[model samples]
Target: MIRTFGFPELLFILDGAKWTVLMSLAAFLFGGLLGLLVALARTSKIRPARFLALCYIQLFQGTPLLIQLFIVYFGLPIIGIRVELWLALITGLSLHASGFLAEIWRGSIQAVPEGQTEAARALGLGYISRMRDVVLPQAFRISLPATVGFMVNLVKGTALAALLGLTELTRAGQLMSNITFEPLKVYATVGLVYFAICLPLTLVSSRLERRLNARG
Candidate 1:
């Protein structure tokens, strides 16, 4: 009963790709908001805020993303927090993205010329106004390339969700391979799908980096 790899299989993978895109978007949206707060805390003059933000960034950056997903999906049940698969996967990915994005933004915030901050201060702008109106805008521009690069990584990282039974692209390939007994064909298609998704973002990231460097 070996089914051939055909249009149906391709459609199945595409469906999985759809979920992959959705999951990545959800993670990035939530993570970006949290990362902004963490970045602000990391750059705050308050020592405790900086210390706590540093520890958060280190915890995620220091560990494997797969482990994080496992802890969310499996470990939580032991502590009486039962999360569904979607919740666990998105939560894990969002946390991971936040850690890296926070660092990227923190550096960009600091890289904004000190004099610009001083000028804002001289105008008697409050801390919130200074960051909202001045510092964050420049930092956003400076962070674009790296942020997109990290997004590329995040898309690839979604493959790990397969381990938790999420049926994203990689899991689709696995199921297709198992049924068709055509691991090579199924996996090659998977790789192509990933390349199709990631290459444009890769090119954009490079273009952005070059543009930033030119302006520097």
Candidate 2:
């Protein structure tokens, strides 16, 4: 008798998707904090801080996340530091997001006219005060769209966590496909679920970008 894909299995898939969303949220919140610090360091006048940030961005951006996952999941255990697959995946994705985000924000911060920084300096504002009161607020507004876009990408990237054995959306699809013997259907459902999650974000980012541009 041929087995059919059923509602119970579909519910399981949906349940798995919740974890995917949660993991993405965790990755982004933690990564955004790290990225902000890296962005500041990248823009620092100190040569050592600048070099450290540059190397961090280069290391993560240059390597595929798959390899990084393997290193953390498998290789780290060799050194007696055993992290669960979920932990490893979150750590890897957070690091990857931080590297790219730092660059995006650094560019946005630099795009602010030099005269703006100079004008702040002319007001007797210290470096931290100038950046806090003047520079970063403007820079954050300019970078908001790109940051949203990055967040969307990070959501999709959670599928990669499946390789580390976390039962997220894609991995759940694989299990469903195995049982139902319907790879196309299972993966199509997975893709649709991902689209449902990501589409609104795309629309929101576009609308925000247009509004920002119009104001400019």
Candidate 3:
């Protein structure tokens, strides 16, 4: 029973964008915090800390997120650990984001000169104080563009949540397309909605990159 592609369907699809945005936000916030820890650990003086962080980053970064999500959501139940859909989605996304962010922040941290760290130490500042006062601020500025670019990728990655039966933007589009039998229209709208959300982010990221380069 095919229906017409109408404004109401379009409106419903638009409404679903809220979930996508929310999911992305949750993933980013939680992931960013965790990633900061990973970055610090990755750069830590302790060999064990670095090794463990490396394993974590490689495990998450090397694997397909779809399989990770499947393991978290489906494979877990086989081992008697029941997982919630949203929880699995957020967890998978968080791990994925954290691994990459850790590397990004780590590189940014390393890019800061050794002399600055030594100078901060000469001022009698401790590790946290040195990073807080001198190192991280600059590293953050250097890393901002890449971080924003990764965020844009994260926004697009939210579509994978549809596989979990979540009626996020992509899932909503799929359902509507089925009912309306208008794959072209529905998908075009979906792409447009994603573009509307991501295009601004892309522009801002580019502008920031240019500004960073200019300042550098």
Candidate 4:
């Protein structure tokens, strides 16, 4: 039963953007936390922690996100485990983002001058205090632009959530296109919606990068 691509369909598709926003937020918040831990572990003095963190990063970063999403949604059930759509999507995206962010932030941390760490050590600051009070702040500023860039990609990654029955923007567009028999219009709208969401972040990332360079 085909229908027309009209105002109502457009509104419905736009409404689905909310879910995309939610999923992106979920992935970023959780993934950022995980990435922080991973970054710390990667930089840890412990050989085992560094090795395990590296393995985790390689496992996630080396794989395609679509395959990871599939493994979460479909593979878990095969192993006698089941997760709801929201959890599954967040898990996949968060793990993906964590890998990249951990590496990104690790670089940021390393980029901070060794002299600062030595000064912190001279001041009797423990490793935790050194990182929390001295290092992470500088590293965060350095990593900000790259972090935002990754987040822009994560926003786009939410489109993949549609594959697991989530009614995100892309999925909504697909469903509308099916009924409206208007793939071109519906998908064009979807692309426009994505552009609208990502363009600002892209601009913001670039601006921040320029500022960082200016400071340097």
Candidate 5:
């Protein structure tokens, strides 16, 4: 029995879209926190800290995200730490995002004028205060465009969760296609849903870039 692609099917895909959004947000939130720490360490004066942070960034950036997902979803059980599908997916995505976001923020932190740091030092600010009150604020502004761009990529990346049996948007499409024998319709709808989610972020990234450049 081939069911037509109808409103119910569309709603099902949309339901999956919600999971996609939730996962992306969760990954971004956790990743951003860890990335900030990594960025700080990457830019630290301590050689060992910088070296370790560099290696951390390289490890994730060097590997395919799918491989990361596999390692998390499959490897953990071997170590006796079983994770649910959503937890595994979020963990893998967060780690991946942390590496990329760390680099983005490290560059942004460095891009802050050296004079700004000197001024903060001259004002007798300590390392934490300097970064918290002075450097990070500017870096945050500088990083907005790239961060949003990466977020757009992250949103697309969530589709990979389908491979791990998480019924995100792409997974939803997969099940729909299987049942309806309508891969074309199902995937086209998937693509449209992805576009709907990503286009605004894309536009925002571009706008932020232009604004930053204009200010520069």
Candidate 6:
């Protein structure tokens, strides 16, 4: 079976890889938008806002992604609201990623030197102005490596969406293997595609982090 791995099967796997990349990008972009709001809420002076952000982060992060997917895909219909598998998968992945990304960005903001904020305040910058002019720009430099790493993880996590019946790379590999009776070759191809997607990002992230550190 491994000896019989064909171009057709390999192409099918590559097609699935494209879907995985698309889903990952969707999850990351939507998650990043929500995560930024959550990060700001967590850092806000209002007690209720901070508490709400904390709860949002903790609830999602404390739950397993598989369980979250199940809740979205299966559990929602119980309330008379039906969601398509792809839609549910995207929602679950984005929400999960948002929780983690929020925390990551919050930590990055805190890692910005205290004096930067203080200096901004002394310059008569308001809260928003301080963040925009002084804190967030520097924090973004520190955050880029972590965000890239999270995106890689998010891409890997798209495989879990297959469990919800969204035909991603892993699910496509399973289907091909079942049809071809070539599990080893099929799975190996799947892994190679994933690595191909991830390894370059990993290298780029490492290089960027090094450059950032050197500049600082």
| C-alpha lDDT values of all predictions | 0.94, 0.88, 0.91, 0.92, 0.94, 0.90
Local distance difference test, candidate 1 = 0.94
**Alpha-carbon error at 75 in model 3, in Å?**
2.9
Q: Which candidate model has the greater lDDT, 1 or 3?
A: 1
Candidate 2: clashing pairs of residues? none
In model 6, the Cα lDDT at residue 76 comes to 90
Q: Residues 1-216, candidate 1, lDDT per residue (tens digit)? A: 899999999999999998898999999999999999999999999999999999999999999999999999999999999999999999999999999999999999999999999999999999999999999988988888889989989999999999889899999999999999999999999999999998998897788778867885
Ranking 2 against 4 by lDDT, winner: 4
- Listed per candidate, the RMSD to the true structure in angstroms reads 1.9, 1.8, 1.8, 2.0, 1.8, 2.0
lDDT of 4 by residue, 1-216 (tens): 789999999899889998998888889999999999999999988999999999999999999999999998899999999999889999999999999999999999999999999999999999899999999988988998889889989999898888778999999999999899989999999999989988988798788778877885
- Model 4 spans with C-alpha error above 4 angstroms: 206-216
Q: What TM-score does candidate 4 reach?
A: 0.91
Instruction: Mark the regions of model 2 whose C-alpha exceeds 4 Å error after superposition.
Output: 210-216
Candidate 2 residue lDDT tens string, 1-216: 445688987898999899999988988888888998999999999999999999999998899878877887889899999998788888888888899899999999898889999999999999899889989988987898889888988898888888777888999998899889988888899999999999888798888778877876
Candidate 5 regions exceeding 4 Å error are 205-216
C-alpha positional error of residue 110 in candidate 2 after TM-score superposition, expressed in Å: 0.8
lDDT of 5 by residue, 43-150 (tens): 999999999999999999999999999999999999999999989999999999999999999999999999999999999999999999999988988899889989
Q: Estimate each model's TM-score.
A: 0.93, 0.92, 0.93, 0.91, 0.94, 0.93
lDDT (tens digit, per residue) of candidate 3 on 1-216: 889999999988988898899888999999999999999999999999999999999998999888888888898889998888988898889888999999999999999999999999999999999888899988988888889889989999999989889998999999999999999999999999998988888798788877877887
Point out the higher-scoring one by lDDT: 3 or 5.
5
Comparing candidate 2 with candidate 5, which one achieves the higher TM-score? Answer: 5
Clashing pairs in 5: none
- Give the Cα-based TM-score of candidate 1 against the true structure: 0.93
How many backbone clashes are present in model 2? 0
